[model samples]
Target: MEGGSSTSGGRSWSIYGRAEITARYEILGSVGSGTYSDVYRARRLSDGLAVALKEVHDYQSSVREIEALQALHGSPNVVDLIEYFWQEDEDAVLVLEFLQTDLETVIREGKRRDGGIEVGEVKQWMVQILRGVDACHRRGIMHRDLKPSNLLIGADGVLKLADFGQSRILNEFEQIPTNEEWMPQPPTIDQGVSHPSVGGYENQAAQEQRPFNQEDYLQQLVDFKTRYGTNDADKESNLQDGDASCLATCSTGDMEDDPYKGSYSFVAEESAEHESGTLTSYVGTRWFRAPELLFGSVSYGLEIDLWSLGCIFAELLSLKPLFPGTSDIDQLGKIISVLGDLTEESCPGCSKLPDYNKISFNKVENPIGLIACLPNRSPSEVNLVKRLVCYDPASRATTMELLLDTYFTEEEPLPTPLSELKVPSTKTTHDGGSLGEFYNYGNMESDSDLEEFGPMDISTTERGFSIRFS
Candidate 1:
């Protein structure tokens, strides 16, 4: 689909009335815009073939995106880069295969109170997303920013990974080790017995089982309330006032702001061994940013993207972000409050992060309960997401492991094919008519990244806060 000649093979229409690229591609209209480029629907003069032309204005950023697409040329579940060429005082013209729309549009247009999309549709999209990520990882690359917007759809409903603006090369990254000593192992099948030495030590491994006692649990809760400075009168009053009011009065003793209060120490344990491109920390979008990234981890690798994927899956299930913090500090507060108080065991070496102790935060435990946030998800589905979005990036599931999760093998909600997706296959973008509505680019002056932060990569850092990259 070269533009050297017109349909007559002599000369083409000069600048299809927009830019020099119009000589080759007939500009239809604007499709969408990124931080560094504006995508337009166009048709080639040689064959009248439809394509997407991304007008990349920044040189360095464009190079990174080009390198990523070139490395993943023929990989499965990834978009194809048709052709690319640059002009001297203008933007670089990147011709890509046209997609019907992106996953972001689908999610937004279909938002509902009854927990977003159906289970089958989410399962299908999850499979496709993981497959695309696996392809990238296998080739030693990391698609740093993988929000819904980056997942594109075709006329036939086939989904593919697109927009490598924030992607990075991993030529010498460490392999995900099979010797997962740090990961928890499945319990062995064995007989269980009660021990008189311990208090009510009943094991599920045994043939017989006994349900837990609720009265005793309440007594323990009362003790916990007592230790935190609440009186017995308050507890009695709470019982009469109802459970919701009772919980509002409970305290956590004191915040963990004092370094000497606990035996925990900030220990340095390098999680991954990436050789280069390691310092630039701003990775995925704000709400999807991993705990390690918020805590200031500059050496993280592919697992960071996995955390973002976990958030995306959660959003698909609930029709909202799992952690939608307005700022970085607020983001951490939301994570601990919803995911339960993080410890060294929960996130090994988390204290060693550069910004770990930079601010003082009151210890906020999960009041409504961790599982309460995901009430509708099955146990296996919840378990899978918990592992991927866990505090420790090193322990996150690889793309292949996620794709092979038992949740996919279950009999109930099977994945739906693209042809069955209830969305139109030929629609384009509608994000037009506003300056503030631009895509997430490097808001370095405000928010940044071409797409590493992604379309919804809102700023999380407060003004004048001394936080490291990412």
Candidate 2:
């Protein structure tokens, strides 16, 4: 991971308390750059082994990514972390096994068969994605920002999960329902003057001023945890313990007989370090986001990733975004147009989301389903897609369940081996996908003569640029 006696191409670079950076590796060229870091392809000076160097501007993000990647080093579908060294006081450099390109680039550059990738290739990539994500979830981690761009591919065509910047560690054994602020308890009459009420405030309704109240929402949320929440049996048992966190007046037998051995303290006592932010709304790129996230549920779990996997699979199969919306509101509308509408009965606790009650959507009666949209795909394939993109987050397929699906296991259309795929893996990002923010053709700011230009006018207004790609 570090220095040898080898000299790096007649130049010298240095880091704090370490050997010169140039002494270990030869900088090849730049790959890409994101908000926090720049990716580069480099070769180890000692053995000439190719490696990817990510020069990070933010130390906090680098440390968080290092912790996550180190925890998931051996997973076949995940990227390998080679080593890291400091560049400056607030900057650090991460060394990783260099990959050729990413899945997004493959989809963009690969020829479209019937307007999508070959069904076999899509299956191969989807299975690999689920396996890599499973590795993360099994280890109690969640890749919060899972999209095509972050999923890298090597020359051997092995898909690796990269970019741990937005990942989260979920310690279920120690976690409470929501990280919320506890109200100051009223004093007792024993000390000095007459303190208002002790046991009284606990029974009263919460004031509307509080953003989230344990008295109203916390207890209600516990009551809403039906048998259908998580797809995993083991995780389901863990969620049952979540009930004990809210019920303060449970019988002595109920408290003693709890399966978790009373490890779960009250939800109120848990620290308010919940979602990555103080108030978790949406944190991912808009298109791949799940319904629960759109509804603004801060208490959502790993199933949200499953929803994203569904969207990715659809994009791979159709060679276009499944639900590309102009904004958050439009995104939700597009989802309903496909999955129908959501009600409290449909998703059970969806209404409890912070923003759920804030907006309303039209109910779609005969919305399009996966089978019709992916007409080229087989019935089994369609079923898996339906399960993965289910309206209820509780019902989406877990990574383990997805691996066991007949569509993947059966021999109807075997997955094309990675080495056999024709697409060349090279350095790229969602292949000009950044143009999405700049060119939302469906909802451009300026008006156009639709009769004269039609839908293509959004991108082709200036020239024949978009028509050439389409």
Candidate 3:
């Protein structure tokens, strides 16, 4: 679908209309854009309620997103999808409850001001996110890509889950593809010397060609472990020294002195049964990928989402992404270095995973030692993070548990509700121009003309849209 327009008339209408639904909400300006969609701030012509409109590129993907939204409508913790429509020419428009800003933006801005998000505020948001996720889980939906960017804060201080593009409806027979096609096959080893063979008792000498570099294959396995496996020496040093400042520094976005900068060292080479270009193979953003996914586990589930939550929580606290790995493999290394390693015994079905055969690690690392990495973090905060980021899906804390954690309850109270936050009702006038002048309907022939522009000319440039109440 084409993006919304930014005309002054469009803005006024968006702010004042009450019962009117139009081809476009009339974009005040671009809010955000991704590979497949663009989001804009708009208003309902009927009620004048401000909303965000997402215009998607692919009809099928848009349909899927709408289905996810339909499943989440009426959910207090989810951004409400009020309605959606397909214009005459197949342009899809989804009207969403508007949010003031996203969590990532808020956290980043706070960092620039040298201020940290209040611990209490963090807890409140965490609770809201969990509430939304819990609702989704009850409906058998998994938000595969749960991250800070997807969590938005309304002007009234309400937190809601926004993006559903990567979400999936889970069921008994969900057809998750395996990763066997993505990983390289292990080289075969020769058991003995080849002997003479004959098809029909006629002597014929045959020599085995031998499989590709077996030693090199073994070395690769060793390298994977050495790089990703937790180092006891490093852990012990941190424990003995009790130097958490270094760890805290790692959590922040400042990466100027980081060792693995400007290198594609994180993502491990793996082939999927599905091609890389396909939607399913596109794992989440590198910084937020869970350990199982980073390690190439094919049968992974919602625990990955929890892992991302843990990372986001850490980032929120530190004003940076928790593990800023340049590649997938490196990302795994950062996780292991901080949270320790996972073994077959701990992760019971791990070996059965697609990339399990490629792993050569023998022992799992200790979880307690890993907690020390978050310098100055309270025990309650660490406990919550660990519970949310557990390797075992069953062991991972439910969203409800996270919401009720003591870190939020004892540390601080929830922020004032968004409805009570004092945001200006109108944009500031510039250059002595009155705000009403931009949307002055002086020469407007009829409301019908604006509504009858068809699908192609729907555009707006106004700062706000108007909705007239009866």
Candidate 4:
């Protein structure tokens, strides 16, 4: 069969060069596009059920997402993965449940309809978001990116976490050895042997006819580990640091005299697969990035997600981003402006961060507190945010703890009933290509479509470094 094709409401949809998938599901329309994948809304031919066909272009991202989804199967508030097709030397196509809209859309629509989302509605959304996050954390998974766009909502008013490309399973950290000799080698699958398929099976009698060689298996395992596993040098260095410990935005030039000030394109860097016990700091959007991540701390945990949650919660209360910074340096400047300086006292052990000393800043005498960020909002709302957005990751409240806070219990305006939620009308995927609607929003995607931040200037004066925000 020619790669499946269909047209809906004068829009055409086609899946290119995948005959096996085409035979099973009919491509409906493009949902969104990302740096590593393109998501399409499709229909299963067997039962006429609608599902999302995620065409993952990056092999590592695909593996991470598939592994996460399988482990998180049946989790509450987590997106459901129906099935997937992975053939050698080709992109993996994951069939997932299609969610109508996302939290970002809800926030935008609420802004347009009313001045802000109703207090009760905001509470309900937060509850659902927390539930999704709790599920991930309980399973030892850190959704490195937890911005509004990644939180999907269905007609049933349920919020499900999606986009596991940046997710990391903490299990590897537990498995990593403290000594060189104790390092365990990874299992190697022989190339000559075809991997088992999810839908098909091999004949047992034919497989039994083949001779097994223990010595060859051991040699191949050693060879594979030597080529792909961690090198002796990396192992030694990484282990030494074990005692110690640890997105994307088109950034403005830090200096006014910089030549690349006016013209800067947002180039998304490919996420590198990290060695066990280490993580890439380049994860999540700049606005929701945690202070540790900002300071270049590689060793982190679920607390990073908590900080992003705090940002998202703040946005819901105010209907705008808590700190909308243009550049990495500027982002830190905005945060420090509101939360004061990052210090040993404010955040114990913060100085130990990799780049904490590298990036210095002028102390803020009068820091604009979280309450000031949420004007007219109840104290409960501010308390909820304060527990998450802090200098110390260890101090950030866990999702389960947040779920039990008075914000959700004993509050005057309780969480809105799920049945009463106004489900957003599902918009058809754009035929004339739009930015990352299915996975992420393009550069323009944010709570506010306000004009981009003006050019910022970073001064390296003897007093202290400061990025002038316009």
lDDT of 4 by residue, 91-125 (tens): 67788998888887777777778556888889999
lDDT of 2 by residue, 1-470 (tens): 12211225422232222345566877866565555565667799889999987766554456567667766655689888776664333245678887766777777765443445666777889889998997776665667778887788887889989887666665442222222222223222122211112212332223343454436543443433343254333443322111111122122433354343244333222222242223222245667777767654545566778888888888787677788865454567678878777776667667655445444554577988676677677677677778889867777767766776777778567788887875554544333433221111122112222122122212222211111101
For TM-score, the strongest prediction is 4
Our model 4 lands, by Cα RMSD against the true structure, at 11.1
lDDT of 3 by residue, 42-82 (tens): 76555678887666655545655666666555567888776
Question: Which is the better candidate, 1 or 3, if ranked by lDDT?
Answer: 1
Highest lDDT scorer: 4
Error of 3 at 438 (Å): 26
Q: Model 2 segments beyond 4 Å from truth?
A: 1-19, 111-116, 173-282, 428-470
Q: After superposition, how far is residue 347 of candidate 2 from its true place, in Å?
A: 0.8
* Residue 293 lDDT in candidate 2: 70
Q: What are the runs in model 4 whose C-alpha is more than 4 Å off?
A: 1-15, 172-278, 427-436, 442-470
212: Cα error in model 4, Å: 46
Instruction: Tell me the lDDT of candidate 2.
Output: 0.58
Models ranked on lDDT: 4, 2, 1, 3
* TM-scores for candidates 1 onward, in order: 0.66, 0.67, 0.60, 0.74
Candidate 1 per-residue lDDT, tens place, 1-470, comes to: 22221223222222233344656677886665555566777898889988887766555456566666765665558887766765443345568888776676667656732446778888888898998887776555677777776788776777889877767666444323221112112112122221111112222233344454545534543443233211122222111111111011111221133222232223222221123323233455667777766665544556677888888887776666787755454566677777765667777666655455543345554344436767777787677778777776656777766775677766467887777876644443344222211233222122211223222212234321232222
lDDT of each: 0.56, 0.58, 0.50, 0.66
Error of 3 at 271 (Å): 14
